[model samples]
Target: MLKIVVGGQINKKEIFDYIQNYYGTENVKLEIKNDLDAVMAMQSGQFDYYIGACNTGGGGALAMAIALLGVTKCKTISMPGKILPDEEIKKAVDDGIVAFGFTASHVEQVLPVLLDAIDHKN
Candidate 1:
């Protein structure tokens, strides 16, 4: 099973619920953590992927991840008025992005694509 950690300034519960519902408990294990602990877990190899949501997607959702995991391993797939294309998200998965961030409002739209890509990737 894939292990995913939820860490963001907002929508932690919603994102966790969405992933659990769509991916199912059988397919993935999830945990909600504060940004620092989450990033540390990720860096220490305790989790496979990270999902976070914020207003801008980048600033709050990914700042800790980017700072700890490095920018190359992290990505902001959506922002306030912008969401990356499905192919791009898939490409990010293929290119090895282990952490993803998006605006809280884009959770429904982004999770399907992101989780699908992650499912296929594993």
Candidate 2:
């Protein structure tokens, strides 16, 4: 199972919907708030990765990654361009989870690059 926490926007259903399309709603989760809440949720050992959304894609994701570093082996994937298809984002999260071993700091640094790779299908 892959867990995703959503940031930005109140109605996070759209993001959830997108993610669910590929991974199924049961696999994807949503937390509609800032990075703090996202990190807290991750600390509970419920999710594998933290997925945050922002207009720029750095602020919320960075905040969550910083909080989870060294504590939770987790990573974050942000869609800055907002062009990522649902399946692509899902695959990015999955691949990140595999390659990074749930290290939050590593995830933070790799998320942008991961998204780019996903976008380009690299």
Candidate 3:
């Protein structure tokens, strides 16, 4: 199973909708809470991966990563490119889950590539 955690009140909805559209409503779990909540959940071994969406994608990622870094196998990915195609982001989810680590200005740029990497890894 793959677990995806979205941070921020407004941003979480946007990312959650995207995940459901691509992965199907039943395939993914949604977390609409502060980054701490998501991170703690992941650390508890309840989730396999996390995807936080703050305005800059840095704050949320940082909070989750810092919390989950030692507790669970975790990674942080960014989309400095603003946003990418939904299909592309979907494909990257698996890889993002597997890689469990990333940080950059443009998260959109690496989302697709990260997905490919995760897919290949599996």
Candidate 4:
């Protein structure tokens, strides 16, 4: 099972719904948290991934995550209308990015690609 924590200065409920719809509850355990709680959870090793969003792709949404997990463990997948290529996402996951951040407006494009990369990372 994959454990995920969604947080930040964006719409966490929408992100949560997308994950639930895509992976289903049987395959994943998810929680909606504030940025602080999300960071704390990651520090405690309570989640496999932390997905966060903000107005910009790499702003407040990821500040704490990057701080706690280090910049090497995080990646910004999308920014406003820009979503990275599938191969780029896969490479990030393969390189061990445990935290993903994106713009709120790009969630629809970001989530599916990000999830697919994670699912196929093995």
Among these predicted structures, which one has the highest lDDT? 1
- Over 1-122, each residue of candidate 2 has an lDDT whose tens digit, in order, gives 44556543232445445545645556445445465665676677655455554444445445555545542343334344334344554565455441121223333343455434433432
Q: What's the lDDT of the predicted structure labeled candidate 1?
A: 0.94
TM-score list, all predictions: 0.98, 0.49, 0.59, 0.95
TM-score of model 2 (CA atoms): 0.49
TM-score pick, better of 2 and 3: 3
lDDT of 4: 0.89
Arrange candidates, best TM-score first: 1, 4, 3, 2
Every candidate's lDDT: 0.94, 0.46, 0.52, 0.89
- Model 2 misplaced stretches (Cα beyond 4 Å): 8-11, 26-34, 70-122
Give residue 82's lDDT in candidate 4 (0 to 100).
82
TM-score of 4: 0.95
Indicate the residue-level lDDT of 5 in model 3: 70
What does candidate 1's lDDT look like per residue over 29-116, in tens digits? 8999999999999999999999999999999999999999999999999999899999999999999999999999999889999989
Worst ten-residue run, lDDT, model 3?
95-104
List clashing residue pairs in candidate 4. Answer: none
TM-score for predicted model 1 compared with the true structure: 0.98
